[model samples]
Target chain A: MLTGVVPDARYWSYTLYGADDYLIPNQDQRYGYNAATMDYVPRDTLNPEASDQWIDQYQIKISADQQEGNWLPAGNNKALSITLRLYNASPTVYENLATIALPEIIKVN
Target chain B: MKKTLIYFLLFCASALVGRTVAIHYLPDYIYSRFSKMALSRPGAAVNQFSVLMAPDENAKLVVKPNPDFAYATLFYDLTDGPIHILGAMPDSIYWSVALYQENTVNFYVKNDMQYDSDTLNIIISDDAMDQEADIEQIVSPEKTGFVLIRVLVAERDEAHQKAISDYLNALQIP
Candidate 1:
């Protein structure tokens, strides 16, 4: 399972790749999730006009089986890779790449 | 004692040979195979930009393709002469042109934020040419390599698709 706060960027996605570095082939044609395609809920319940209080948090379940929401298909391979791409990312993210807050990958049985 | 010395020498020579092959020959061989597969794609060729739609499960031309970005890829062979790339910057959130040698070494990359004007007139050659007033020059390390342009699409709606199409149409390669 992968969970974190989506970065404030123009575009972001988490694409799953096979051990060979190519994309994992699946029948559903679902390779990954972008900021536009992801399902997220705001942390704060502020007034509708207060856009500054909204924080988009997301969780992605990566497994061979179908999950409830934001399912990144892992196929049958146990050893795979996931690439997180952020386009037009904030300067903070680029400057703090070594200390940036990345999604936590929890191994779920 | 003599046999032991000979065995040690053979092992050292084999290790050195293996290291050289792995470092020098392996990457080039792999890149050649990859370039062959990439060039075999329909509408993809040297010196011509091939606009690739959004990637999915079937998109295997490259590794780790972002679904939100539309790509215009071109392979250039500088053996004959230089290649001219002229295009206007797309009004997208993020865009960039990245160049890589045949050995998969990234030589140059210029993003939207790095440019001041909306127009780009780049001359890619093996050696640097005289700087013109409004032209940018890129000296590729390899005679044959690849150039990739990435355009970000926040949404896959009709408007975004048309915008990408218009951007591609405006780009001139000569």
Candidate 2:
């Protein structure tokens, strides 16, 4: 899992890719969020205004059941890569971007 | 002869146990002492730092970046497992976080998606607060490992940078 804080008038996005570096199938279709109506929704549901605003806080969650192929290889193992981009909507360019990583994994028998 | 061999084996077992105890308990003892020092000393302004730990209540470490910029990281170690991070910035800036293997060179994960951009006169924004990317398939490859935390502060001032650093350092496993 990953989380970040974004200021006003700016936008942030999170995308997920399978171990093979391809877009994962979104059966629920609610994989991203924005500032105006910043909340988790199914991927299939489309927000008309999603293309027009910025998001303040974003959270990304990955579950074990949602994976198609073995992300960690054959031995009950897995690895994943994430790409995050931030865009400044104002004329004044923003400096370096800050990010925090939150690990969300538990082994439950 | 059998008695001599048994004594030797007993001595070796005792030595191994002592070594294991020292390795496991030494850092905790040192960390407590340092934490006490930090609290007793005159409060210095905070600096930029990163906190890494596992979601579990046991493994956690707070890392502060050196203000002098001479060192890339103020602290790091592998006495624990997994990795959790929390950070803060003083100014309005953008940042990205990535996870890499122990090699210190390659990033297994990177996040760089943005919602909008503005030109000289025209402004474009994407209300992406609701955008969700499916990450349920992601997993860590290592059985016992660590995660890296990186922060980028827009302004290079002392106080803001310190806050970022201090916050990261204060993170606890709980």
Top candidate, metric DockQ: 1
What would the TM-scores of all predictions be? 0.80, 0.25
Worst 10 residues of 2 chain A by lDDT: A68-77
Fnat value of model 2:
0.00
Query: Candidate 1 — what's its lDDT?
Result: 0.81
Among all candidates shown, the one with the greatest TM-score: 1
After superposing candidate 1 on the true structure, give the runs of residues whose Cα lies further than 4 Å from its correct spot. Answer: A8-10, A18-21, A24-28, A44-53, A63-68, A75-79, A88-91, A107-109, B1-7, B156-159
Which lDDT tens digits does candidate 1 get at residues B92-149? 4578899998777898998888887777789899988888878888998878898888
Q: A-chain TM-score per prediction? A: 0.82, 0.46
Provide the lDDT at B118 for model 2.
13
